[model samples]
Target: MWNEILHRSWLRLEQNYHFNDSQNVLNVLKQAYAESQRAYHTLQHISECLFHFEQVQDLLGDARAVELALWFHDAVYNPKASDNEECSATLFQDLLKDDLSTALLAKISQWIIATKQHLPSSDQDLNLLLDIDLAILGATSKRFIEYQQQIQCEYHWVDSEIYQHKHKQVLTHFFLQQPLYQTTFFQDHFELQAKQNLTLALAGNLK
Candidate 1:
Protein backbone atom coordinates (compact mmCIF):
# COMPACT_ATOMS: atom_id res chain seq x y z
CA MET A 1 0.00 0.00 0.00
CA TRP A 2 2.71 2.47 0.95
CA ASN A 3 4.80 1.38 -2.00
CA GLU A 4 2.19 2.22 -4.61
CA ILE A 5 1.06 5.43 -2.96
CA LEU A 6 4.60 6.61 -2.23
CA HIS A 7 5.71 5.73 -5.71
CA ARG A 8 2.90 7.72 -7.25
CA SER A 9 3.73 10.78 -5.21
CA TRP A 10 7.44 10.43 -5.94
CA LEU A 11 6.84 10.19 -9.66
CA ARG A 12 4.53 13.17 -9.69
CA LEU A 13 6.99 15.24 -7.71
CA GLU A 14 9.66 14.24 -10.22
CA GLN A 15 12.40 14.74 -7.71
CA ASN A 16 15.96 13.59 -8.05
CA TYR A 17 15.43 11.49 -4.99
CA HIS A 18 15.55 7.88 -3.95
CA PHE A 19 13.52 5.86 -1.46
CA ASN A 20 15.40 2.60 -1.61
CA ASP A 21 14.92 3.12 2.11
CA SER A 22 11.18 2.77 1.45
CA GLN A 23 10.94 -0.65 3.08
CA ASN A 24 12.62 0.65 6.22
CA VAL A 25 10.23 3.56 6.51
CA LEU A 26 7.24 1.31 5.91
CA ASN A 27 8.39 -1.08 8.62
CA VAL A 28 8.66 1.72 11.17
CA LEU A 29 5.22 3.06 10.27
CA LYS A 30 3.73 -0.42 10.48
CA GLN A 31 5.24 -0.77 13.92
CA ALA A 32 3.83 2.58 14.98
CA TYR A 33 0.34 1.69 13.87
CA ALA A 34 0.59 -1.76 15.43
CA GLU A 35 1.25 -0.51 18.91
CA SER A 36 -0.82 -2.42 21.49
CA GLN A 37 -2.44 0.66 23.03
CA ARG A 38 -4.21 1.74 19.87
CA ALA A 39 -7.86 0.82 19.44
CA TYR A 40 -8.21 3.25 16.53
CA HIS A 41 -5.73 5.39 14.60
CA THR A 42 -4.32 2.16 13.35
CA LEU A 43 -3.51 0.93 9.86
CA GLN A 44 -7.17 0.14 9.38
CA HIS A 45 -7.99 3.82 9.85
CA ILE A 46 -5.41 4.75 7.21
CA SER A 47 -6.95 2.22 4.85
CA GLU A 48 -10.36 3.75 5.47
CA CYS A 49 -9.02 7.24 4.78
CA LEU A 50 -7.49 5.99 1.57
CA PHE A 51 -10.86 4.60 0.56
CA HIS A 52 -12.37 8.06 0.94
CA PHE A 53 -9.43 9.67 -0.86
CA GLU A 54 -10.15 7.49 -3.88
CA GLN A 55 -13.72 8.77 -3.94
CA VAL A 56 -12.75 12.44 -4.39
CA GLN A 57 -9.38 12.20 -6.09
CA ASP A 58 -10.53 14.19 -9.08
CA LEU A 59 -11.67 17.10 -6.93
CA LEU A 60 -8.33 17.68 -5.22
CA GLY A 61 -5.78 20.34 -6.17
CA ASP A 62 -3.01 17.83 -5.61
CA ALA A 63 -4.06 14.23 -5.37
CA ARG A 64 -0.58 13.03 -4.64
CA ALA A 65 -0.07 15.56 -1.87
CA VAL A 66 -3.46 14.74 -0.39
CA GLU A 67 -2.69 11.05 -0.45
CA LEU A 68 0.74 11.63 1.00
CA ALA A 69 -0.70 13.68 3.84
CA LEU A 70 -3.36 11.03 4.48
CA TRP A 71 -0.72 8.36 4.84
CA PHE A 72 1.09 10.38 7.49
CA HIS A 73 -1.81 12.24 9.16
CA ASP A 74 -2.34 9.91 12.09
CA ALA A 75 0.96 8.17 11.69
CA VAL A 76 2.05 9.22 15.17
CA TYR A 77 -1.25 9.17 17.07
CA ASN A 78 -1.15 9.20 20.85
CA PRO A 79 -4.59 9.44 22.39
CA LYS A 80 -3.11 10.89 25.56
CA ALA A 81 -1.02 13.54 23.84
CA SER A 82 -1.85 16.83 22.12
CA ASP A 83 1.31 16.93 20.01
CA ASN A 84 0.60 13.91 17.86
CA GLU A 85 0.09 16.00 14.75
CA GLU A 86 3.30 17.88 15.29
CA CYS A 87 5.18 14.65 15.83
CA SER A 88 3.58 13.06 12.78
CA ALA A 89 4.34 16.01 10.55
CA THR A 90 7.91 16.17 11.77
CA LEU A 91 8.36 12.49 11.13
CA PHE A 92 6.99 12.95 7.59
CA GLN A 93 9.38 15.77 6.74
CA ASP A 94 12.31 14.10 8.43
CA LEU A 95 11.84 10.94 6.43
CA LEU A 96 11.02 12.51 3.07
CA LYS A 97 12.75 15.87 3.26
CA ASP A 98 15.29 14.93 0.66
CA ASP A 99 12.57 14.10 -1.84
CA LEU A 100 10.15 16.99 -1.31
CA SER A 101 10.45 20.74 -1.80
CA THR A 102 10.09 23.06 1.18
CA ALA A 103 6.71 24.24 -0.10
CA LEU A 104 5.44 20.69 -0.46
CA LEU A 105 6.77 19.89 2.97
CA ALA A 106 4.88 22.81 4.45
CA LYS A 107 1.76 21.84 2.55
CA ILE A 108 1.83 18.27 3.85
CA SER A 109 2.73 19.28 7.38
CA GLN A 110 0.00 21.90 7.44
CA TRP A 111 -2.57 19.41 6.22
CA ILE A 112 -1.71 17.05 9.05
CA ILE A 113 -1.80 19.93 11.51
CA ALA A 114 -5.24 21.00 10.25
CA THR A 115 -6.64 17.60 11.18
CA LYS A 116 -6.06 18.47 14.83
CA GLN A 117 -9.31 20.45 14.53
CA HIS A 118 -10.78 19.38 11.20
CA LEU A 119 -11.86 22.97 10.96
CA PRO A 120 -13.17 24.50 7.80
CA SER A 121 -10.43 25.54 5.38
CA SER A 122 -10.02 27.52 2.13
CA ASP A 123 -7.48 25.29 0.41
CA GLN A 124 -9.02 22.73 -1.91
CA ASP A 125 -6.51 20.02 -1.11
CA LEU A 126 -6.77 20.78 2.57
CA ASN A 127 -10.58 20.75 2.47
CA LEU A 128 -10.74 17.42 0.70
CA LEU A 129 -8.13 15.96 3.02
CA LEU A 130 -10.08 17.19 6.03
CA ASP A 131 -13.27 15.73 4.60
CA ILE A 132 -11.56 12.41 3.98
CA ASP A 133 -10.13 12.28 7.51
CA LEU A 134 -13.56 12.98 8.95
CA ALA A 135 -15.63 10.77 6.67
CA ILE A 136 -15.94 8.37 9.60
CA LEU A 137 -18.30 10.79 11.28
CA GLY A 138 -20.80 10.23 8.48
CA ALA A 139 -20.27 6.52 8.11
CA THR A 140 -23.11 4.02 8.47
CA SER A 141 -24.78 3.88 11.86
CA LYS A 142 -23.11 0.59 12.75
CA ARG A 143 -19.68 1.86 11.83
CA PHE A 144 -20.27 5.12 13.62
CA ILE A 145 -21.16 3.24 16.78
CA GLU A 146 -18.12 1.08 16.37
CA TYR A 147 -16.01 4.19 15.97
CA GLN A 148 -17.36 5.52 19.26
CA GLN A 149 -16.53 2.28 20.96
CA GLN A 150 -13.07 2.27 19.49
CA ILE A 151 -12.48 5.77 20.77
CA GLN A 152 -13.61 4.79 24.23
CA CYS A 153 -11.30 1.84 24.26
CA GLU A 154 -8.39 4.05 23.28
CA TYR A 155 -9.07 6.22 26.30
CA HIS A 156 -9.93 3.43 28.71
CA TRP A 157 -7.38 4.70 31.15
CA VAL A 158 -9.38 7.83 31.85
CA ASP A 159 -12.12 7.78 34.49
CA SER A 160 -15.52 7.02 33.02
CA GLU A 161 -17.05 10.33 34.08
CA ILE A 162 -14.12 12.44 32.96
CA TYR A 163 -13.95 10.58 29.68
CA GLN A 164 -17.67 10.90 29.12
CA HIS A 165 -17.71 14.64 29.80
CA LYS A 166 -14.63 15.31 27.70
CA HIS A 167 -15.93 13.08 24.95
CA LYS A 168 -19.19 14.98 24.91
CA GLN A 169 -17.30 18.23 24.52
CA VAL A 170 -15.43 16.83 21.53
CA LEU A 171 -18.61 15.58 19.91
CA THR A 172 -20.22 18.91 20.60
CA HIS A 173 -17.38 20.67 18.89
CA PHE A 174 -18.00 18.77 15.68
CA PHE A 175 -21.74 19.07 16.20
CA LEU A 176 -21.32 22.83 16.33
CA GLN A 177 -19.49 23.06 13.02
CA GLN A 178 -21.98 25.21 11.07
CA PRO A 179 -21.31 22.83 8.23
CA LEU A 180 -19.31 19.76 9.17
CA TYR A 181 -18.54 18.58 5.69
CA GLN A 182 -16.48 21.09 3.74
CA THR A 183 -16.53 19.98 0.10
CA THR A 184 -19.72 19.73 -1.93
CA PHE A 185 -19.18 16.02 -2.46
CA PHE A 186 -18.90 15.34 1.26
CA GLN A 187 -21.59 17.85 2.06
CA ASP A 188 -23.96 16.04 -0.27
CA HIS A 189 -23.14 12.53 0.87
CA PHE A 190 -22.40 13.02 4.57
CA GLU A 191 -23.77 16.26 5.96
CA LEU A 192 -27.24 14.98 6.87
CA GLN A 193 -26.16 11.61 8.25
CA ALA A 194 -23.25 13.18 10.12
CA LYS A 195 -25.56 15.67 11.75
CA GLN A 196 -27.83 12.83 12.77
CA ASN A 197 -24.91 10.87 14.18
CA LEU A 198 -23.56 13.82 16.15
CA THR A 199 -26.98 14.74 17.45
CA LEU A 200 -27.62 11.21 18.62
CA ALA A 201 -24.17 10.89 20.13
CA LEU A 202 -24.60 14.15 22.00
CA ALA A 203 -28.04 13.02 23.19
CA GLY A 204 -26.39 9.98 24.83
CA ASN A 205 -27.80 7.53 22.31
CA LEU A 206 -24.58 5.65 21.64
CA LYS A 207 -24.26 3.85 24.99
Candidate 2:
Protein backbone atom coordinates (compact mmCIF):
# COMPACT_ATOMS: atom_id res chain seq x y z
CA MET A 1 0.00 0.00 0.00
CA TRP A 2 2.77 2.42 0.94
CA ASN A 3 4.71 1.49 -2.17
CA GLU A 4 1.66 2.21 -4.28
CA ILE A 5 1.29 5.61 -2.62
CA LEU A 6 4.97 6.35 -3.22
CA HIS A 7 4.65 5.32 -6.85
CA ARG A 8 1.66 7.59 -7.38
CA SER A 9 3.32 10.51 -5.59
CA TRP A 10 6.45 10.02 -7.66
CA LEU A 11 4.30 10.00 -10.79
CA ARG A 12 2.82 13.31 -9.72
CA LEU A 13 6.33 14.74 -9.40
CA GLU A 14 7.23 13.27 -12.76
CA GLN A 15 4.60 15.49 -14.32
CA ASN A 16 6.59 18.59 -13.38
CA TYR A 17 10.12 17.31 -13.96
CA HIS A 18 11.65 14.09 -15.10
CA PHE A 19 13.83 12.32 -12.57
CA ASN A 20 15.64 9.03 -13.18
CA ASP A 21 16.54 8.06 -9.63
CA SER A 22 13.01 7.95 -8.21
CA GLN A 23 13.43 4.35 -7.17
CA ASN A 24 16.47 5.15 -5.02
CA VAL A 25 14.73 8.11 -3.46
CA LEU A 26 11.70 5.98 -2.70
CA ASN A 27 13.91 3.38 -1.03
CA VAL A 28 15.50 6.04 1.18
CA LEU A 29 12.10 7.37 2.20
CA LYS A 30 10.93 3.87 2.99
CA GLN A 31 13.95 3.32 5.17
CA ALA A 32 13.28 6.56 7.04
CA TYR A 33 9.72 5.52 7.76
CA ALA A 34 10.87 2.04 8.78
CA GLU A 35 13.42 3.27 11.28
CA SER A 36 13.53 1.20 14.48
CA GLN A 37 13.07 4.22 16.76
CA ARG A 38 9.76 5.14 15.17
CA ALA A 39 6.53 3.89 16.69
CA TYR A 40 3.94 6.57 15.92
CA HIS A 41 5.92 8.38 13.22
CA THR A 42 6.12 5.36 10.96
CA LEU A 43 4.86 4.46 7.50
CA GLN A 44 1.46 3.86 9.06
CA HIS A 45 1.29 7.54 10.02
CA ILE A 46 2.05 8.59 6.45
CA SER A 47 -0.64 6.24 5.17
CA GLU A 48 -3.11 7.75 7.61
CA CYS A 49 -2.30 11.24 6.42
CA LEU A 50 -2.70 10.14 2.81
CA PHE A 51 -6.07 8.64 3.59
CA HIS A 52 -7.20 11.91 5.15
CA PHE A 53 -5.77 13.97 2.30
CA GLU A 54 -7.80 12.02 -0.27
CA GLN A 55 -10.97 12.86 1.61
CA VAL A 56 -10.34 16.60 1.18
CA GLN A 57 -8.21 16.75 -1.94
CA ASP A 58 -10.69 18.96 -3.74
CA LEU A 59 -10.29 21.68 -1.12
CA LEU A 60 -6.56 22.02 -1.62
CA GLY A 61 -4.98 24.70 -3.82
CA ASP A 62 -2.14 22.36 -4.74
CA ALA A 63 -3.00 18.78 -3.94
CA ARG A 64 0.24 17.42 -5.27
CA ALA A 65 2.38 19.71 -3.11
CA VAL A 66 0.37 18.86 -0.01
CA GLU A 67 0.69 15.14 -0.74
CA LEU A 68 4.43 15.45 -1.21
CA ALA A 69 4.72 17.42 2.02
CA LEU A 70 2.99 14.62 3.93
CA TRP A 71 5.53 12.17 2.59
CA PHE A 72 8.45 14.19 4.00
CA HIS A 73 6.87 15.82 7.07
CA ASP A 74 8.21 13.24 9.46
CA ALA A 75 10.99 11.89 7.28
CA VAL A 76 13.59 12.99 9.81
CA TYR A 77 11.76 12.49 13.11
CA ASN A 78 13.79 12.11 16.27
CA PRO A 79 11.97 12.26 19.58
CA LYS A 80 14.84 14.08 21.21
CA ALA A 81 15.57 16.40 18.33
CA SER A 82 14.13 19.94 18.23
CA ASP A 83 14.93 20.48 14.55
CA ASN A 84 13.23 17.44 13.08
CA GLU A 85 10.89 19.55 10.96
CA GLU A 86 13.74 21.72 9.70
CA CYS A 87 15.80 18.66 8.89
CA SER A 88 12.88 16.94 7.21
CA ALA A 89 12.09 20.02 5.15
CA THR A 90 15.74 20.28 4.13
CA LEU A 91 15.72 16.64 3.08
CA PHE A 92 12.54 17.20 1.08
CA GLN A 93 14.07 20.13 -0.77
CA ASP A 94 17.36 18.28 -1.31
CA LEU A 95 15.57 15.30 -2.82
CA LEU A 96 13.11 17.18 -5.02
CA LYS A 97 14.81 20.51 -5.82
CA ASP A 98 15.76 19.24 -9.24
CA ASP A 99 12.22 18.05 -9.96
CA LEU A 100 10.13 20.88 -8.54
CA SER A 101 9.99 24.60 -9.07
CA THR A 102 11.54 26.84 -6.43
CA ALA A 103 8.16 28.32 -5.52
CA LEU A 104 6.51 24.91 -5.06
CA LEU A 105 9.45 23.64 -3.03
CA ALA A 106 9.20 26.62 -0.72
CA LYS A 107 5.48 26.04 -0.28
CA ILE A 108 6.09 22.40 0.56
CA SER A 109 8.76 23.39 3.07
CA GLN A 110 6.33 25.79 4.74
CA TRP A 111 3.70 23.07 4.97
CA ILE A 112 6.15 20.66 6.61
CA ILE A 113 7.20 23.29 9.15
CA ALA A 114 3.57 24.06 10.02
CA THR A 115 3.28 20.60 11.54
CA LYS A 116 5.47 21.78 14.41
CA GLN A 117 2.78 24.11 15.77
CA HIS A 118 -0.34 22.53 14.25
CA LEU A 119 -1.83 26.00 14.16
CA PRO A 120 -4.21 27.40 11.60
CA SER A 121 -2.63 29.40 8.79
CA SER A 122 -3.94 31.79 6.12
CA ASP A 123 -3.18 29.16 3.49
CA GLN A 124 -6.06 26.73 3.08
CA ASP A 125 -3.81 23.93 1.90
CA LEU A 126 -1.59 24.42 4.92
CA ASN A 127 -4.60 24.30 7.25
CA LEU A 128 -5.66 21.00 5.70
CA LEU A 129 -2.17 19.60 5.93
CA LEU A 130 -2.00 20.40 9.62
CA ASP A 131 -5.42 18.87 10.15
CA ILE A 132 -4.43 15.61 8.46
CA ASP A 133 -1.22 15.45 10.45
CA LEU A 134 -3.19 15.63 13.69
CA ALA A 135 -6.23 13.49 12.80
CA ILE A 136 -4.97 10.69 14.99
CA LEU A 137 -5.80 12.81 18.03
CA GLY A 138 -9.48 12.17 17.32
CA ALA A 139 -9.21 8.43 16.72
CA THR A 140 -11.23 5.79 18.54
CA SER A 141 -10.47 5.09 22.16
CA LYS A 142 -8.50 1.95 21.47
CA ARG A 143 -6.48 3.54 18.73
CA PHE A 144 -5.92 6.67 20.78
CA ILE A 145 -4.57 4.58 23.63
CA GLU A 146 -2.33 2.74 21.24
CA TYR A 147 -1.02 6.06 19.92
CA GLN A 148 -0.21 7.22 23.43
CA GLN A 149 1.67 4.02 24.08
CA GLN A 150 3.56 4.31 20.85
CA ILE A 151 4.55 7.88 21.73
CA GLN A 152 5.82 6.71 25.07
CA CYS A 153 7.88 4.06 23.37
CA GLU A 154 9.38 6.70 21.11
CA TYR A 155 10.34 8.75 24.14
CA HIS A 156 11.36 5.88 26.38
CA TRP A 157 14.49 7.68 27.45
CA VAL A 158 12.52 10.27 29.39
CA ASP A 159 11.73 9.64 33.05
CA SER A 160 8.06 8.81 33.61
CA GLU A 161 7.27 11.83 35.81
CA ILE A 162 9.06 14.22 33.51
CA TYR A 163 7.33 12.79 30.50
CA GLN A 164 3.91 13.19 32.07
CA HIS A 165 4.64 16.77 33.04
CA LYS A 166 5.76 17.66 29.54
CA HIS A 167 2.89 15.74 27.98
CA LYS A 168 0.37 17.62 30.09
CA GLN A 169 1.80 20.95 28.98
CA VAL A 170 1.48 19.93 25.35
CA LEU A 171 -2.12 18.79 25.82
CA THR A 172 -2.95 21.98 27.65
CA HIS A 173 -1.66 24.08 24.79
CA PHE A 174 -3.95 22.25 22.38
CA PHE A 175 -6.90 22.70 24.68
CA LEU A 176 -6.22 26.38 24.89
CA GLN A 177 -6.24 26.73 21.14
CA GLN A 178 -9.64 28.05 20.06
CA PRO A 179 -10.22 25.27 17.55
CA LEU A 180 -7.93 22.31 17.44
CA TYR A 181 -8.61 21.63 13.77
CA GLN A 182 -8.77 24.37 11.17
CA THR A 183 -10.51 22.57 8.30
CA THR A 184 -14.28 22.20 8.35
CA PHE A 185 -13.87 18.52 7.49
CA PHE A 186 -11.74 17.82 10.53
CA GLN A 187 -13.59 20.31 12.73
CA ASP A 188 -16.89 18.58 12.02
CA HIS A 189 -15.61 15.03 12.40
CA PHE A 190 -12.96 15.32 15.07
CA GLU A 191 -13.34 18.50 17.11
CA LEU A 192 -15.33 17.00 19.96
CA GLN A 193 -13.61 13.65 20.14
CA ALA A 194 -10.21 15.32 19.98
CA LYS A 195 -11.05 17.44 22.98
CA GLN A 196 -12.30 14.40 24.84
CA ASN A 197 -9.17 12.42 24.01
CA LEU A 198 -6.83 15.18 25.06
CA THR A 199 -8.76 15.86 28.24
CA LEU A 200 -8.74 12.21 29.21
CA ALA A 201 -5.08 11.77 28.49
CA LEU A 202 -4.12 14.90 30.38
CA ALA A 203 -6.22 13.89 33.34
CA GLY A 204 -4.63 10.45 33.56
CA ASN A 205 -7.88 8.77 32.57
CA LEU A 206 -6.84 7.38 29.19
CA LYS A 207 -4.20 5.01 30.49
Candidate 3:
Protein backbone atom coordinates (compact mmCIF):
# COMPACT_ATOMS: atom_id res chain seq x y z
CA MET A 1 0.00 0.00 0.00
CA TRP A 2 2.75 2.44 0.98
CA ASN A 3 4.83 1.29 -1.97
CA GLU A 4 1.97 1.92 -4.38
CA ILE A 5 1.39 5.44 -3.10
CA LEU A 6 5.08 6.32 -3.20
CA HIS A 7 5.48 4.77 -6.65
CA ARG A 8 2.59 6.82 -8.01
CA SER A 9 4.24 9.95 -6.64
CA TRP A 10 7.49 9.06 -8.41
CA LEU A 11 5.83 8.33 -11.73
CA ARG A 12 4.07 11.70 -11.76
CA LEU A 13 6.78 13.78 -10.13
CA GLU A 14 7.49 15.77 -13.28
CA GLN A 15 7.28 15.22 -17.04
CA ASN A 16 10.28 17.36 -17.90
CA TYR A 17 12.72 14.44 -17.74
CA HIS A 18 12.03 10.80 -18.50
CA PHE A 19 12.39 8.51 -15.49
CA ASN A 20 13.10 4.80 -15.25
CA ASP A 21 10.99 2.04 -13.73
CA SER A 22 9.76 3.31 -10.37
CA GLN A 23 9.19 -0.18 -8.99
CA ASN A 24 12.88 -0.87 -9.29
CA VAL A 25 13.54 2.33 -7.40
CA LEU A 26 11.11 1.30 -4.70
CA ASN A 27 12.71 -2.14 -4.54
CA VAL A 28 16.04 -0.53 -3.84
CA LEU A 29 14.46 1.51 -1.10
CA LYS A 30 12.89 -1.58 0.49
CA GLN A 31 16.24 -3.32 0.40
CA ALA A 32 17.95 -0.37 2.06
CA TYR A 33 15.41 -0.25 4.89
CA ALA A 34 15.66 -4.00 5.34
CA GLU A 35 19.42 -3.84 5.88
CA SER A 36 20.43 -5.92 8.92
CA GLN A 37 22.29 -3.01 10.43
CA ARG A 38 19.07 -1.08 10.97
CA ALA A 39 16.73 -1.39 13.94
CA TYR A 40 14.71 1.81 13.91
CA HIS A 41 15.43 3.43 10.56
CA THR A 42 13.40 0.86 8.71
CA LEU A 43 10.24 0.63 6.63
CA GLN A 44 8.33 0.86 9.88
CA HIS A 45 9.77 4.31 10.49
CA ILE A 46 8.94 5.39 6.97
CA SER A 47 5.44 4.02 7.27
CA GLU A 48 4.93 5.86 10.52
CA CYS A 49 6.15 9.03 8.87
CA LEU A 50 3.83 8.51 5.95
CA PHE A 51 0.95 8.04 8.35
CA HIS A 52 1.72 11.37 9.93
CA PHE A 53 2.08 12.95 6.51
CA GLU A 54 -1.36 11.78 5.52
CA GLN A 55 -2.77 13.56 8.55
CA VAL A 56 -1.55 17.09 7.83
CA GLN A 57 -0.59 16.79 4.19
CA ASP A 58 -3.39 19.16 3.19
CA LEU A 59 -1.57 21.98 4.98
CA LEU A 60 1.54 21.68 2.86
CA GLY A 61 2.15 23.91 -0.17
CA ASP A 62 3.84 21.13 -2.14
CA ALA A 63 2.65 18.05 -0.34
CA ARG A 64 3.80 15.62 -2.98
CA ALA A 65 7.35 16.97 -2.91
CA VAL A 66 7.29 16.80 0.86
CA GLU A 67 6.02 13.22 0.60
CA LEU A 68 8.82 12.44 -1.84
CA ALA A 69 11.34 13.88 0.54
CA LEU A 70 9.90 11.78 3.36
CA TRP A 71 10.20 8.74 1.15
CA PHE A 72 13.89 9.39 0.57
CA HIS A 73 14.94 11.24 3.71
CA ASP A 74 16.34 8.18 5.40
CA ALA A 75 17.46 6.38 2.27
CA VAL A 76 20.90 6.27 3.79
CA TYR A 77 21.24 5.19 7.40
CA ASN A 78 24.24 4.27 9.49
CA PRO A 79 23.98 4.45 13.26
CA LYS A 80 27.70 5.13 13.56
CA ALA A 81 28.00 7.54 10.64
CA SER A 82 27.39 11.29 10.82
CA ASP A 83 26.82 11.89 7.10
CA ASN A 84 23.70 9.76 6.72
CA GLU A 85 21.47 12.74 5.97
CA GLU A 86 23.83 14.11 3.33
CA CYS A 87 24.20 10.70 1.75
CA SER A 88 20.43 10.24 1.74
CA ALA A 89 20.01 13.63 0.08
CA THR A 90 22.63 12.69 -2.50
CA LEU A 91 20.85 9.45 -3.22
CA PHE A 92 17.61 11.37 -3.85
CA GLN A 93 19.44 13.81 -6.10
CA ASP A 94 21.12 11.07 -8.12
CA LEU A 95 17.94 9.13 -8.67
CA LEU A 96 15.64 12.03 -9.63
CA LYS A 97 17.88 14.73 -11.08
CA ASP A 98 16.66 13.80 -14.54
CA ASP A 99 13.00 14.08 -13.57
CA LEU A 100 12.40 16.87 -11.05
CA SER A 101 13.09 20.52 -11.65
CA THR A 102 16.50 21.55 -10.36
CA ALA A 103 14.94 23.98 -7.90
CA LEU A 104 12.50 21.37 -6.58
CA LEU A 105 15.32 18.85 -6.36
CA ALA A 106 17.38 21.32 -4.37
CA LYS A 107 14.52 22.01 -1.97
CA ILE A 108 13.81 18.31 -1.54
CA SER A 109 17.46 17.66 -0.84
CA GLN A 110 17.48 20.47 1.70
CA TRP A 111 14.35 18.99 3.33
CA ILE A 112 15.98 15.57 3.55
CA ILE A 113 19.21 17.00 4.96
CA ALA A 114 17.29 19.06 7.47
CA THR A 115 16.32 15.89 9.33
CA LYS A 116 19.91 15.67 10.53
CA GLN A 117 19.40 18.21 13.30
CA HIS A 118 15.58 18.30 13.08
CA LEU A 119 15.95 22.00 13.72
CA PRO A 120 13.16 24.57 13.44
CA SER A 121 12.66 26.02 9.95
CA SER A 122 11.02 29.16 8.61
CA ASP A 123 9.53 27.02 5.87
CA GLN A 124 6.16 25.58 6.87
CA ASP A 125 6.56 22.54 4.65
CA LEU A 126 9.90 21.74 6.23
CA ASN A 127 8.52 22.23 9.71
CA LEU A 128 5.72 19.72 9.02
CA LEU A 129 8.09 17.17 7.51
CA LEU A 130 10.49 17.37 10.42
CA ASP A 131 7.65 17.05 12.87
CA ILE A 132 6.51 13.92 11.09
CA ASP A 133 9.99 12.45 11.20
CA LEU A 134 10.22 12.99 14.92
CA ALA A 135 6.68 11.91 15.65
CA ILE A 136 8.00 8.85 17.40
CA LEU A 137 9.24 11.10 20.13
CA GLY A 138 5.65 11.80 21.03
CA ALA A 139 4.22 8.40 20.34
CA THR A 140 2.22 6.49 22.91
CA SER A 141 4.14 5.22 25.93
CA LYS A 142 4.56 1.70 24.58
CA ARG A 143 5.72 2.94 21.20
CA PHE A 144 8.04 5.50 22.74
CA ILE A 145 9.73 2.79 24.81
CA GLU A 146 9.96 0.66 21.70
CA TYR A 147 11.61 3.53 19.88
CA GLN A 148 14.18 3.87 22.66
CA GLN A 149 14.91 0.18 22.46
CA GLN A 150 15.13 0.29 18.70
CA ILE A 151 17.62 3.14 18.87
CA GLN A 152 19.64 1.25 21.45
CA CYS A 153 19.69 -1.80 19.24
CA GLU A 154 20.98 0.27 16.33
CA TYR A 155 23.95 1.43 18.39
CA HIS A 156 24.39 -1.79 20.32
CA TRP A 157 28.02 -1.96 19.18
CA VAL A 158 28.89 0.98 21.40
CA ASP A 159 29.99 0.31 24.97
CA SER A 160 27.11 0.41 27.42
CA GLU A 161 28.42 3.34 29.47
CA ILE A 162 29.30 5.45 26.44
CA TYR A 163 25.98 4.76 24.78
CA GLN A 164 24.17 5.59 27.97
CA HIS A 165 25.86 8.95 28.38
CA LYS A 166 25.47 9.93 24.76
CA HIS A 167 21.89 8.77 24.68
CA LYS A 168 21.09 10.89 27.71
CA GLN A 169 22.68 13.89 26.07
CA VAL A 170 20.63 13.32 22.96
CA LEU A 171 17.42 13.08 24.97
CA THR A 172 18.33 16.20 26.96
CA HIS A 173 18.97 18.21 23.84
CA PHE A 174 15.55 17.34 22.47
CA PHE A 175 13.98 17.99 25.85
CA LEU A 176 15.45 21.46 25.81
CA GLN A 177 13.96 22.38 22.44
CA GLN A 178 11.78 25.42 23.22
CA PRO A 179 8.94 23.80 21.32
CA LEU A 180 9.90 20.27 20.41
CA TYR A 181 7.56 20.19 17.45
CA GLN A 182 7.50 23.20 15.11
CA THR A 183 3.99 22.73 13.74
CA THR A 184 0.76 23.60 15.49
CA PHE A 185 -0.83 20.24 14.80
CA PHE A 186 1.98 18.28 16.40
CA GLN A 187 2.31 20.84 19.16
CA ASP A 188 -1.38 20.58 19.92
CA HIS A 189 -1.54 16.82 19.74
CA PHE A 190 1.80 15.49 20.91
CA GLU A 191 3.75 18.20 22.64
CA LEU A 192 2.57 17.48 26.18
CA GLN A 193 3.04 13.73 25.90
CA ALA A 194 6.39 14.22 24.18
CA LYS A 195 7.67 16.42 26.94
CA GLN A 196 6.49 13.92 29.53
CA ASN A 197 8.19 11.12 27.65
CA LEU A 198 11.41 13.09 27.36
CA THR A 199 11.31 14.04 31.03
CA LEU A 200 11.00 10.42 32.02
CA ALA A 201 13.85 9.33 29.77
CA LEU A 202 16.12 12.09 31.03
CA ALA A 203 15.36 11.05 34.59
CA GLY A 204 16.31 7.46 33.76
CA ASN A 205 12.78 6.14 34.29
CA LEU A 206 11.77 5.25 30.76
CA LYS A 207 14.25 2.46 30.11
The model with the greatest TM-score is 2
The TM-scores, one per candidate, come to 0.90, 0.93, 0.92
Candidate 1 error regions (>4 Å):
1-18
- lDDT (tens digit, per residue) of candidate 2 on 18-125: 666777777789899999999999988898788788889899988878888998999999898999999999998898788778998898998898899786689898
Looking at model 3, report the run of 10 residues with the lowest lDDT sum: 8-17
What stretches of model 2 exceed 4 Å from their correct place? 1-18
What would the per-residue lDDT of candidate 1 be over residues 1-207, giving only the tens digit for each residue? 744654554454344344547666667777888898888788778877877887888888788788878878988978889999999999999988877789989989999999997877778889999998899999988889999999999999999999999999989988888788889999999999999999999987865
lDDT of 3 by residue, 85-175 (tens): 9999999888778778899999999999999998888999999999999899999988999999999999999999999999999999989
Cα error, residue 51 of model 3, in Å, equals: 0.2
Q: Which stretches of candidate 3 lie over 4 Å from their true place?
A: 1-19
Score candidate 1 by lDDT.
Answer: 0.84
Better of 1 and 2 by lDDT: 2
Clashes of each: 0, 0, 0
TM-score of 3: 0.92
Show the colliding residue pairs in model 3: none
